[model samples]
Structures are given as C-alpha cells and as structure tokens.
Target: MDQERARLLASVLAPGVSEYVVLLMEGDPASKARPRFGGGRTYKTAADTAAETATGWALRRSFRQPWTGNVGLGCVFFRPNRQRIDTDNLVKHVCDAGNGIAWVDDAQITAEFGVVELDVEHPRTLIVVTRHVSSLDRSDLVGTMPRPRRTR
Candidate 1:
C-alpha cells in the first residue's frame, strides 16, 4: 500500500486504550483469531496510552504471484470475548467515520472505493498495529494442508 493510503487508514483506527496483536498464520485458511492479553484495565488515549512497537515480527509464509499486500487495517473494542477480537466493529466504525473513503466487507478492502474516503468532520488519530507472520517456525506450509493431486 502507498504511504497516503497507509496514513489515511492509520488515522481512522481511533485505537482505544486496549492494544491489539495481528496474528499471521501460514498455510492456514483466511481466518482471524482474537487477541490474547492478560485481563486488566482498558487503556484509553488520555491515560498512559503510549505507542509501542510490536515484537516477534516476521513473515511466516510466502504467497504466489498476484498476491495483494498483507497489511490490512482493522480494529477492536472492549468486548466479552477479547480473545476473539471483533473485526465487525472496526469495519462499522471506519465506514461510519470515513463517510465512504474506504470500502470494507467480509471479502475485501478498497481504499478510496467508498463514498467518503476520509473523516475530516470527526477527525480521528489512529494507532498503527503491525502484524508479524507466525508461520516461520512451523512446517514449510504452516497454515496449509496438502491435498491429493486431481486428474483432469
């Protein structure tokens, strides 16, 4: 993604006090799991909500050509199942805030594909959440299962 797009996405994140983790699975299907953290107080931007770089960063798998970039803008809020972080809320918040700048669905994200591309009315300063791929230490195909070759 380009810097402008990245910057715009980051701006709308409106990251709450609670930090998040991006889990990249190799060979695994396109599935997302909730973040794992020690249950505690929910941090807000006003409190000691300083930004920190995410560790254990690495791309655990390789994709074929024509592959789009890995980085995707997402969000989370205080919920009963923090472990199963909700992407739905993030989408709703962004869509509402953006007034149409970004388009998001269960399938894809297109920058500048919606009605309002940025939120100047309710300007939001977002927090960047870097996702580190977790397929490096596992088998070559960390998130994939081998299928028998089919004859035509």
Candidate 2:
C-alpha cells in the first residue's frame, strides 16, 4: 500500500468498531456491464466477469468475514483518462463483487456514495465499508428537519 492509501485506511478506522473494512484496488476501475442474452441464457460479458473476479479477490484479502448487519458503502474511482462513465455503474460492480466477502448481499448496504475522477498516473478504486449509522442516531440532526404536525 502506498502512503496516501495507508493514511486513508487509517483515517476511517475507529478504535472500537470492528466492522469497518477498506479495500484499495490498483487498476483502471471497471463499470458494471449489462448482462447479455443468447442461446437461451443470460450471462455476463467476459470482461465484466474478469473484472468482478479480480475485485472479489482484492476484497476477500481485506475482509475475512461478511458483515451481517446494515452496511454503508462508499467508493472513489480514479479513472485513467477523462472518459465519461456512469458513477452508478462503477458502484454497482464494486458492490456486486463484494458479495459473500465484504457482506452477505448487496442489499445489506443501506447507504451508498460514490465519486469518479481522473487520475492519469495511478488509476484505482478505493472502497470503504462500515456499519450503517442512521441520521436518527446522531445528535446533530437538530434543525435539519421539522417535526410533523399532529392532526386530530
């Protein structure tokens, strides 16, 4: 791991939280390709399959057990070029690749955020998984929303 990545991973770590996981995959990030239908079968493209496999391997190396509770997933995609790509597609691939490794299923992810940017020198994907913390659980929610008016 490089110094920047190491610092990032350390920053997300909480002393008592054991469910946090961070994975840094070094390569041009791949988006989730649409499934193809042929010969009466629906299947993923070879490129998509290979990308998912590689992502899964990287995730497995970082997270040993799956998180059973609600999870919050965040990702930062550094692209090799200034090509336009859907951030949703990129996030989808990472979430799907984490199945059975980072979490039991992608549905367990209750919160998600993603960002895509250009990094011609070192393109990579950074993923962070942590236990979901709802806004209701925070003390700073004051004035953020008004209480519902009671109707008799």
Candidate with top TM-score is: 2
> Best by lDDT, which number?
2
Model 2 lDDT per residue over 16-132, tens place: 345566677888999999999999999999999999999998987777566666677878899999888999999999999988777777876777878897889999988888776
User: What would the per-residue lDDT of candidate 1 be over residues 38-98, giving only the tens digit for each residue?
Assistant: 5575433321111110111121112111112122344322222223324453334333322
- C-alpha lDDT of all candidate models, in order: 0.27, 0.76
The 10 consecutive residues of candidate 2 with the worst lDDT sum are 136-145
Q: RMSD (Cα, Å) of candidate 1?
A: 17.1
- Which pairs of residues collide in candidate 2? none
Model 1: weakest 10-residue lDDT segment is 47-56
Candidate 2 residue runs with Cα over 4 Å from true position: 1-19, 135-152
How well does model 2 score by local distance difference test? 0.76
Model 2 RMSD, rounded to 1 decimal: 11.9
TM-score of each: 0.18, 0.76
| Steric clashes per prediction | 12, 0
